[model samples]
Target: MSLIVQKFGGSSLANMQRVFNVARIVTQTYNQGHSVVVVVSAQGDTTDELLSKAYEINEEPSKREMDVLLSSGEQISMALLAMAIEKLGYHVVSLTGRQAGILTNSRYGSARIKSIETERLFKELDAKNIVIVAGFQGWNKYDDITTLGRGGSDTTAVALAASLHADVCEIYTDVDGVFTADPRIVGNPSKLRDISYDEMLELASLGANVLHNRSVEMAKKYGVKLVVRSSLNDSEGTVVKEVGSVEKMYVRGVARDNDIARIAVIGIEDKPGMAFKLFSLLARERISIDVILQSIGRDDTNDISFTVKKADLQKSLGVIRENLGMLNAKEVKYSENYSKVSVVGAGMVNNPGVASMMFEALYDADINIHMITTSEMKISVLVDVEKAERAVNAIHDKFKLGEINS
Candidate 1:
């Protein structure tokens, strides 16, 4: 039998009953003669609660200490899950990320997986035992614990599947599968049966929470097939692979990101390397930039505006304020009242008028677009946060994404 890697989200194992539910799922897979490796995140809201507690003690908690504290959530999930499997008479062992030989870069909060040592996993799997590994964390060269930030657990599961050469990497989430749009808001979004890696990458990066962007990157690189399914039931889920059946498709999914802020550096020198200098400063601080625009020089000066996550707004502003003179920028202006709406599909790269269709939809809805960015597979626009849902609905309806994906 082939090996399989399954990842359970926090909601899947929120409590003891859910832990037993997960164990039953894992045991069933193992009972069928296939070796099983399970990766799990912290139980429901455990990571958030940990952060709240940390903030209560120290307003600005150090990332290193936060890493130590946050890593405990997954550890708890792993242990309880292992015990649950044992109660069912299955031979099982739980391992933390470090104990499983997951090596990562030194970045405390958003560490990338450097490499995974598979000896420990192989040993346990060969002994006919199910292996449970904590997701989202790893050990750095300095032996300090580090995390992969948002969707880190998804990345962890994908990496493990690739390292162990598992047959499929199943990511169990709250939703049954990937949808044409968020069903909760769109009222009747359709689920996609399959999607390509490129399409999924664009959606994930643009803010589809179904899978993490880096995990898709790793899966594409390692040729690991991924399935997004619901943990609560046995339902057919969407498959993400190198290629899909729908090559003629466009607008596979519509995604929106509300945790966004736009910052404009006004009155910059408008010289060569000026933009580089300012962005380099943010990069040095590990702040991410998205949807950048530079206005034409007016009054012998230019304005550079860019978007970043709302959480990074303060740090980005601090960096800009600190390097204003070096950047030759006069002032920094920022607002957290924006959301990003994007349409993602591989066919967009080959098809024409995708952006025109999206703009037409927004025009009909009377939504004002602040900034626009288009890539080979996607078109993204910034709109008022309050109207983000309406924009997504308009765009989804315009493209008939539900019909095509349905």
Candidate 2:
């Protein structure tokens, strides 16, 4: 029998009826004579509610304790899902991340999985038991409960699939499949039939939110297959594999990230090691940067602008400000009014006019581009957060991405 690893997001298990709905989806796959393993996220708003409760008690709760608290959301989902499967006359068992033998580093709220001991998973699967795993959590080296940050459930599922060598890992969400643009932002965006791992990775990192970027990275590294589909329907989902369709689609999808803040180091010395010293300080603090632009040196000084997630704004500002004199920088300036909009596709590597076309779209839409960055597979532009949605629709329409045969 083929082995399948399935993951359900919070929306799929939001209520009792939805939980049972997920259970039936699992059992139906089992009835087809395949070995099934399921991973699940917290129910609707459970994680948020828990975070609110924690903040109410302590504005700055201990990271270890927060991990412990957040991890419970997935555990509740696993148990309730297991109970539903049992009621459907299926042999089922629930296991937490630790119980399932997932080991991670001691990073508390953003731990990276070190390794997974698959002996327990194999034994349970061999016994014909449907294994339900609590996603987004694992035990660290210090024996402390740790979480894998937001959207970590997707990483958990892919990691499990790689460890078990499952035939396929299906990620069930609220949408039917990956769309050219977020449906809420762009009307009538087309759904991709399939996408390459690299394309999906760029989209995820650029903020498509259909899948996690780390999961896509792992899938690419281990050659694991992924399918993203809706849990509430039987639609054919989007397939993510090593190579996508052979069609010459220059732009496959448009994505917008509103969670970014721009930081500019103003009046920095235009010397050789200044930029290096400035960024190295932020790196030491584990802050990630994106879409960097360096202004031409004038008057022996230059301005460097870059973007970071909004969550890291304060930390990043603190790091830069504290080291301003050391790096020969004058001042640190930041703004939370900017957002990133990107278009991703493998074809962009060999295509010309992609950037100009994207710019043209923005120009037509009366939007201003602040910063730009490009790679072989993607192009990202920063614009006003308030105009981000219009920018996305403009870019998507410029490429005619919504057309079925485009």
List TM-score per model, in order: 0.96, 0.98
Q: Report the C-alpha lDDT of model 1 over 161-192, residue by residue, as the tens digit.
A: 99999999999988998998888789878888
Candidate 2 residue lDDT tens string, 1-406: 9999999999999999999999999999999999999999999999999999999999999999999999999999999999999999999999999999999999889999999999999999999999999999999877889999977899999999999999999999999999999999999799999999999999999999899999999999999999999999999999999998736576899999999999999989888988899889889988999989999756899999999999899999998888888978878889999989999989887889999999999999999999999898999999999999999999999999889645
Span of ten consecutive residues with least summed lDDT in model 1: 243-252
Clashes of 2: 0
What are the lDDT scores of the predictions, listed in order? 0.92, 0.94
Top-scoring candidate (TM-score): 2
- Model 1 residue runs over 4 Å out of place are none
Winning model by lDDT: 2
